[model samples]
Each structure stands twice: as structure tokens, then as C-alpha cells.
Target chain A: MDTKTLCDGILDGQRRALSKAITLVESARADHRVQAAALLEALKAAQASPREALRIGLSGTPGVGKSTFIESFGMALVREGLKVAVLAVDPSSARSGGSILGDKTRMELLSREAGAFIRPSPSQTELGGVARRTREAVALCEAAGFDVVLIETVGVGQSETVVSEMSDLFVLLLAPAGGDELQGVKRGIMEMADLILVNKADGDLKAAANRTRADYAAALRLLRKRPQDPDGFPKALAISALQEDGLAQAWAEMGTLADWRRAQGHWARTRANQNRHWFMEELRLALLAQLTQAGPVRDAVARLGDSVASGTTTPALAVQSALALLHP
Target chain B: MDTKTLCDGILDGQRRALSKAITLVESARADHRVQAAALLEALKAAQASPREALRIGLSGTPGVGKSTFIESFGMALVREGLKVAVLAVDPSSARSGGSILGDKTRMELLSREAGAFIRPSPSQTELGGVARRTREAVALCEAAGFDVVLIETVGVGQSETVVSEMSDLFVLLLAPAGGDELQGVKRGIMEMADLILVNKADGDLKAAANRTRADYAAALRLLRKRPQDPDGFPKALAISALQEDGLAQAWAEMGTLADWRRAQGHWARTRANQNRHWFMEELRLALLAQLTQAGPVRDAVARLGDSVASGTTTPALAVQSALALLHP
Candidate 1:
């Protein structure tokens, strides 16, 4: 379809059109990129007023029941007449040959819901590309009138941090364990989290779940409170996806936090800051790409890098030589 | 002094010459930078054979007794007839107007020792500058026949990670505390550490110190082992810097780890990789500097940044517009 048709179909909340638009954005081809940009611009222009979905970034270690929690929580949201979209940013999928959310069967209930849409994106060997495409997809979903957009990433490496940049609320899901398991959670990730939900809180794990929740609560209290958060925010709660326990409370807490942020103007401010950050980041990446576009600059970088590695020249001196090649 | 005389003095292990050279490297003036590069080149050329020092990066939060530990450790090394150098990288000092190691009286005994040399460097508004200068200082110390160089940084922020780039080993110093305190320690810094020492392990705090050490030991074990580390590496131990306990043991462990790395060829490989990393980083910073230099491009960046922040256009599109201004 052409850009107008794609924009109209997306604005009407057509699943096929949304999927096609996302695929276009994810494409590496130069021509597809141009078309994708046009489609997005058309969508943005077509809207009488901006429609924004609550972008929730969710991250968890492998086997943390992320899909189960999402399925249950998404079902709850859809039951309230909310349109939900789930987008996955699995950078590892490019290397591992499988996206974590590649199989829709994992969220069978949510997938069957008429108000829910799910899509998984591959990293394509660069995190910046993945993030940019995913962010664009989020815009497409918002244009499709989704009330909530869930961005999921594995709790490894820097992907969660990247996800947080595009999200209004960042949630970390964890399996119930003692302090040992918490150690596996990077403090940097913990610091980024607005809410931490300890899954598998039912059956034999209930007591352990409570303990982990308390531990994280204490730990969160020790962290310097961010000005964006209201009082008693960034706390942990225990939930069981299988039992459907604590979902309501979790949802309520999320709503409260979102409402407070919106009231306090942090929501708009944060989105604006995020946009500025991505703009600068994209510009930097584009500039760097110029040096590596199958040119003499690339060759010079390699040659100087070898010299640096061999200790024949200092990195500062090597950088001076490289910059001279660029500016000359 | 001229570069030739400076090189000769450094090679002769003159403290005055080493201090002057470091000041030159740390200067922001263009002329001084050129002179610093010349002096460093002279020293590198003058070395008949590479005199490598065991570069140890030490970091801790304020009040972690870093100075005390360094003092005792330096005295121990000096007692064994080894020359030691301590370099501080305090990024906050520039803004705070107080260097953590500005007062030589903090390490009174070590400061008076003929075998020890100490210097503090300010961040000067950019971490890249601080890291570059500190790395150069490390080279100067090695050239001056120091057997060991300790690069110290406050445990907050990215300074420790930066110091780790220039050091052979990274050590984290912590005061006696429970799991709650450990939660305050960013996991990224912990992962970078090869050794963790719980300081103030004497008097009333000894028991707590031992417990903290064990906790970190467990946490370290849970972290994936790096290939460079030998078996049972990245361990934590308790020590009393005030009482001078465990200093010898810590030194012995460091020596063993360093010797193993040298024997296994990781030492040279790591340094080469570090050099390559720095070369690329410097090149990236230089390219970015070009964009910020006085020109229409800088003005365009500011204008486009405002537009992006206002959400008038998408970041990708904004980047395209910015890049057109550069490459057109």
C-alpha cells in the first residue's frame, strides 16, 4: 500500500497495516527507509491532535515468567476496554536467531484478544537501529489508538537501559529469590526501574516472594529518591501470573504513578528529554557512519588502530592523525 | 624543561621531573599539550626495554579509607624496596574545588618516602580529558621505574570504569556494611572489580566487615567469570587499613593475579585492547568536537535540538536534516 493508505489503515487500527508499517520501519533498505519516514510523517500529520499510548518498558531475566505476566496483565487491560500493543526489542535475537517474543503462542490468551496486538523486532546487529525502529513502531502503535504499549527486553546488557529511554514507565520483573538472585540484577538496572514486580508469588514461593519484595523495598528506599517520583514510589510487590494475584494492585499502582507524573508535568518533560537524547544520539551515529562508509577514512582508522595496539603511537596522537585525515 | 631533559630526568626516576611532566599532560593549553606529547614520545623512545608496572585501579566511596589503605600498602611495597606511584582521578574535584588527594598529609608516611610518588588530577569538565591525562601519568610512572601504579577514583559514577581502562587490575574498597549497603554499590562497578576489599575491618566493625566480604565473595562468584581471570579469582577479603592487617595478603593476591595474567599473555593482550579502545574513543570525541566548534553547524544543531525537544519532528528526521547540513 501507499503511504496515505498505510497511514489511514493505521489510524483506523487495522492490524495488518500496523504490522506492515512496522516492517517498513525495520527494513534496512534505503528506499524502504524513505517510504517509512513518509508514512510516519503522514500519520503524524493526519492526526488532529496527538494520541499517546502509555509506553511501559518491561524487562526480566530469562525464565522470569515475563510472557505469563504480560499475558495476564494485558488481558486485564483489554478487559477494561483498553487497546494494548506489545513490542519486543531483543538485541540478542540477531545473534541467537530467535526473538524471545517470536512465538505468539507464549501469550495465547492475550494474543487471542481483539484489543491486543503483539510484535517482536530483531536487532539487525546494531542496538541504535533496533531502538530507533522500535521507537518508530511505538509511534505507529499510538497512531493505531492503542491505549497501552508494552516494550519488553531481556534483562541483560544495556538493552533495558535503552528501553527505558523510550518508555514512560520502566518495570522490572523478577523471580522470587533471596539476596543471591538479586545480586544477578545489576544495580544500574535496579536504579532505572520505577517498579519491580516479583513474579511467582504463589504456592511454595509465597514466603520467599514476600522476603524478596521486602528486600527490594528496603534497597529502593536506600536509593536517592528521584524528583520525578512521588512519595513512596519505586517499590516492589509480589505477584503470581499463574494465580492472577496482585495484578489489580500492580495495575492500580501503575495508574497512580502515571497519573501523578502526568499531573506533575514529568511525563511531558521526560518525553521531551528522551526525544532530545535520541536526536543527539542519532546525529552522532550518523556522523560516525561517515567515517566507515567503505572509504579511505575507514582504512586509515584500521591502520592507526593497529599502530595504537602495537604501542607505536599514543591514542591521543593516533586520534589527531585520524582527525587530520577527516578534516583535510 | 625541554622534552629531552624531561625524558632524561624521568628515566633517572626524578620525582620533580615526573610531576612536571604530568602537569604538562594535564594542561588544557594547546602549546602545553604539544610539549606533553613530545615529552611522552621522548620517554617512550628512550626506554631500552619496556618497564611495565602493575597498574591497579582502586575506588571507594568517600570515607571508605582509601587513603589509609594506600598509605599502608605503599609503605609495605616500599619496605620491600619497590617504587610505588599513586594517581588520583577525581572528576568531582573540578566542580567541588577540592581534590580528594590534594593534601599530601593524608598519606603522610608514604608521602615522605623516597620510594613513593603521588599526584591528583582534576576532571577539567570532561571525563575523557581526565582519563587521558591519568593514562599518560601512568606511562610516566612506569617510565620512572615505579614497580606499581595505583590509579584511585571515587566509587561514584563512571570514574571507576574509566580508571579500570588504564589499569591492569581494578579493586573496590568498601566499608563494613550489610546487604543494604551493597545495594548502593552499582553492579557495573562491582563487575569491573577484580578484587574487593572491605576496609575498616578492625575494632568494632571487624565482624561486619567479614560478613560484608563474604557477601561480596558470593556475589562475585555469581558473576560470570571473565577469561582473563584464573580459577577462584575476583574474590573479596576483609582488611583494616588503620591496623595494617591483610595489606600483605592483598598485595600477595594482586601479585599472583598479575603474574598469572602475564604468564598467560592476558596482560599484553588487555593493554593492546585498551589502547585500541582509547584510540577509537578519542577519535569519536574529536569528530564530535568538530560539530560543536563555532560554525553554522553548531547553530543548526541547537536549532534542530530545540525542534526535536518540542516534538516538531522525529529524531531520525532531525538527524537527517542535520546530516544534510554537514554533507551537502
Candidate 2:
């Protein structure tokens, strides 16, 4: 239960300790947060692990067979002598007070595999807080000798984009016959998708799946590609999770893409950028929280906010006035 | 002129004083900034200007006939007994130590018009700083009884988005035979465009202009409409600045859109939001500047930045460590 024991157990690949460590980081209690931070610091400093895990983010709409795809994909990795870890991020989980474990029956095989670890999404209230904890969980998993970490999230709002930032490869799963309308695909999701997979390519859906793959491929070609993408442009493929088909092909493509990125040094650069981004974000959020607590600063924003609302003051000038109070 | 006299002269529509006031705000000198801010405060608090101007943003590629279109548009407005002010925003002007005065010859008629004010883009090093000065210049023009303010910028980088935020309506100008390729359009510019105009539609290019308009209209249909758009999706049209054709139709569309937005309360809401956004941006910039100035904070960042680069530290934890030093 102590930070040292929990960290040691985690480093030793003890499932119980890993679960408990995740809970500690996800906890809202002040004491738990302090202890969790200490454990993370120790784990990070002591981590001399030989090889780092591939952090993959998988996002799909409901009924896209995300759970089934993850199960099959995870099992494939485990079959290759790799230890896999799955961490789900569902911001809407707060509404139902549920995690992705609501249907653990779907991941039966992978859940029971000794080589794979499936942790339910944390039931955290804030998106940023949940994302931070999940990112920390990834570190623990890496230290615990997990060679592959899979992040699963539903394609909704900004959650997918946030998840994509912490990932090395982002895979977007789409169901066959899901209509290729640009309106159907949110702009943010389309822009962030590093690869597109048309799921349910088995039986009657085989032709439809191929058509969907073509449609997505064309869409990706027309869309502006990410500047940091070392693999040129995002490519689309067809897969059937029900039959456990195309899982190996998808995995191979991911490996090739990852390999190219690593060779080009973009992988390291991107990881460093993510760290710096998160660092600045945390600093900004903390500073804002502190600034709001100051009486004079609060008063300034309130008064200036009203003026700005009433069209009496410009935002730039209002900011100037507010900054004066903060630094004075 | 002193701050008070400059403010008074700006209010009185004295061209010399108005130019001087704009120069003051655009100046990087410390004393000039203090004086500029004072003048803005005085102008904002004093001016009970009747009927605010319609802020219109115009952007296009370098050879998209932006200056010709603006000259025609400005002339049309002035002929209608409305005083128009055009403020150009060229962030790259800092590099060449130039504004768009090269086009002054092209805007000869409008430049000599008594009812029009044409100010070239200020040569500012920073985008935010330039944008802030431009916003202030907008307020000064409004106080000086300009009934229509036209903001012109090349559709490059973030300037288009920044200009769009301050404007009541944003118009994106294109040329005939421009191919209308989605890949050619920047995603940010496409998303923010309230109106799409295919300029140079006169004579032989008329057919191509119509085709470009139709293509853009289809593309616009596919884009997710802005949530705050009370007038629905953006519309596309073809215009000819050379023959001064379609100017009236484009002007009428803007008028209708502006009228609808104002009636729906989105006009005021959007302006207030822009103010709040700028206020937060300024606060963040100021906090960052202050943080960098402190020796302890700078030293911590330098150490953590190295760790981040060397892959030894996570960005979130680095931020936490950095915050501790700040708050301590």
C-alpha cells in the first residue's frame, strides 16, 4: 500500500500493485495525489527498461467493434511474445458512472491472457485530469515490462484528439457502410487520424468494406496531412474483427509506420514535443487556478469581463488591465 | 501630439492625428506603448459613436487580386455615402520593412477619395502584437465615424483566423482557374470563411469563375457549419473587380448576413467572446514572460527542458516540478 512497495511491485509486474497504483493516481484525494506523484517520480527516475513500448491509440464510433478489434489485436501481439496493456478513455463515462468494463465479456480471451493487461477506464470527472492519470498509467505499464500499450476511446468531441497526442500511432476504426460524408466525419477526428481501418470486412460486408476503404483513402488524399507524419499520408485498410481477420496486416502496417518514424527521428521529436506541451499546459492551468484565487485578480476580471460584455472595453485592453493586477 | 490631443483628433476624424495615433500603438517603444494605451482608454471611454461600423475581413492569395477587389469594394461603399477604413495586416511586412504600399498605385482612386481611409499594414514583429494594434486601430476608426472597416490580409498562417475573429463578416477571395482544389486551401481559412468570392470574373474568366463558385459551394456544404452562425452556412459568389461587376451582389449578401447575425444576438456574443479570448491570450503571454524572467524558474525550465529532450522526464511531471518552484 505504501508508495515504495507499490512502485516496487509495479516494476516487478505484479498485477495487484499495478491496479492499485492506477487507482492512487486516479484518486481525487489530496494525500493520494501526493503519494501518487512520489511513486511516479521514483518509477520514472529508476526506469532503465531496455526497450520502450509502442503507445497506440485506437478510436471508433459505437458499434465499430472497437472492443472486439482491440481484443483480437491485443491477442495477436501477446502471441508474438509481447506484453500488452489496454487503457480506455471515455469522458462520457461520467454520465453513466461506467468504464469500458461495462462489457468485459467482449474481451474475454484477452482479459484472461497472462501476457495482456486490460484496465478499465478511470471514472474521473475532468477530461484533463483523466488524461494526465492515464498518461501516468502508461509509464507504469512501460516500467512493468508491457511491450505494447493500447489506448481506446470513442470518437467524440475532443477526447480522440487528446488521446492521439499521447500516442505514437493513431488508428481510426470505421464500420463498413458508415457513409463517407465529410459531415459524418468530424473535422478534428479526420485531421488526427494517422490510419483508417474499415472494420467488419467478413462475410456479407466484404465488398462494402473494400468500398469504404477506397472512400476513406480518397478522403485522406484530399485532406491536408499532418506535417509531422513521417509516413507521408495516412493509408486506409479493411479488417474484420469478428473473424479475427486482417489483424496481422493492420499490425504489420503499424509496425512499418512506426519503424519509418523512428528512422526519421520524428518519433523522438514528437514524444519530446508532447512532454513539453503537457508541461506548459499543466503550468498554465495551475497558474490560472492560483490567479483566480487572488481577490484583486478576481475583481479585475469580473469588472473587465462586464465591460467587455457590454462592448465598453476591448479584450486586449482588458487583458492589459488584468495583467497589471497579477504582476503588480 | 499628446495622448489626449491624439485621442481628440482621432475622434474628430483628423487624418494626420489618426495616422499619428495608429503609429503610436504600432510602435514598439516603451513610452509610445504607454501613450497608445492611454489614448485607447480615453477614446474607448469617451466615444459615444453612433451606429458602429460593419467590420469585414478580406483575404486571398498573393495574386488573387486582393488589392483590386478591396479598391472596388471601398469605392462602392464610399459612393453610397459611407466612410470606409481599410487596415491591412501583413505579419511578413516586418521582414521586408515594407507594408502593402506597392498596391497603393493600384488603389489610386480609392486612396484619393475623401470618404475613404486606406492604411497599409503596420510592420510588426509578432502576430498577436500586430493583431492587438490592429484591433485598437479598428476602435479608433469607429470613433472617427468610419461606418465600414475593411481588414485585408494574405491568406497565410494564423493571420486570417486572427482577422476573422474581429470582423463581423469574413470574405475569402479566389481567382478564376485557381483549380478549386481542397488540398490547396488551408483548413483554418476554409473553416473560418463566411463568404467565398471568385474575383476576376470579368470577360473570358467568367465561366471559370462560375465553376469555382459552384465547387466552393459544394465544399462549403460538406463543412460543418459554425455553431454561432445564425445566418447558416457561408455562401459563394463570383465577382469582377476589373469591371466592378457583382460588387453590389456581394455587398448585399454581407448586409443580409450582418443584419441576421445582429438580430440573432450572435453578433454581440461573438464580439464579447473575441475579447475574452484575447484577454486570456494576453494573460498567458504575460505570465510566460514573467516566469521566464525569474532566475529560479528559468533554471528549472532549462534543466527540465534538457531532461525532456533526453527522454528522461515526462512533460506533465516536469510542469509539476516547475509549478512548485513558482508557487513556493
- Which of the numbered candidates is closest to the native, going by highest lDDT? 1
Cα RMSD of predicted structure 1:
6.5
- Per-chain TM-score of chain A in candidate 1 equals 0.89
Clash count, one per candidate: 0, 0
Tens-place lDDT per residue, model 2, A1-328, is 8988998898899999999998887875546766877888788777775347899999888888898898888988999999999998887787776565573666899999999998888876678877877887887888788999999988887788779878999999998885546535587887788889899998999998998889888878877666656544698999998898889988888888898889888898888877766666556655665455546667777788778767787665676787676656
What lDDT does model 2 reach?
0.80
Candidate 2: CAPRI quality band: acceptable
Quote model 2's TM-score. 0.68
TM-score of chain A of each: 0.89, 0.85
- Across B1-328, the per-residue lDDT of candidate 2 in tens digits comes to 8878887788788988888888887775546766776787788777665347899998898888888888898999899999999998878887866565565676889999988988888876688778878887887788888999999988787899889877989999988764547535588898888899998888888998988888888878887577656544699899998899999999998988888888888888888887766666656655665455647677777787778666776665676787676656
Clashing pairs in 2: none
Across A20-74, the per-residue lDDT of candidate 1 in tens digits comes to 9999998866578778878877887788787999999999999989989999999
Worst 10 residues of 1 chain B by lDDT: B96-105
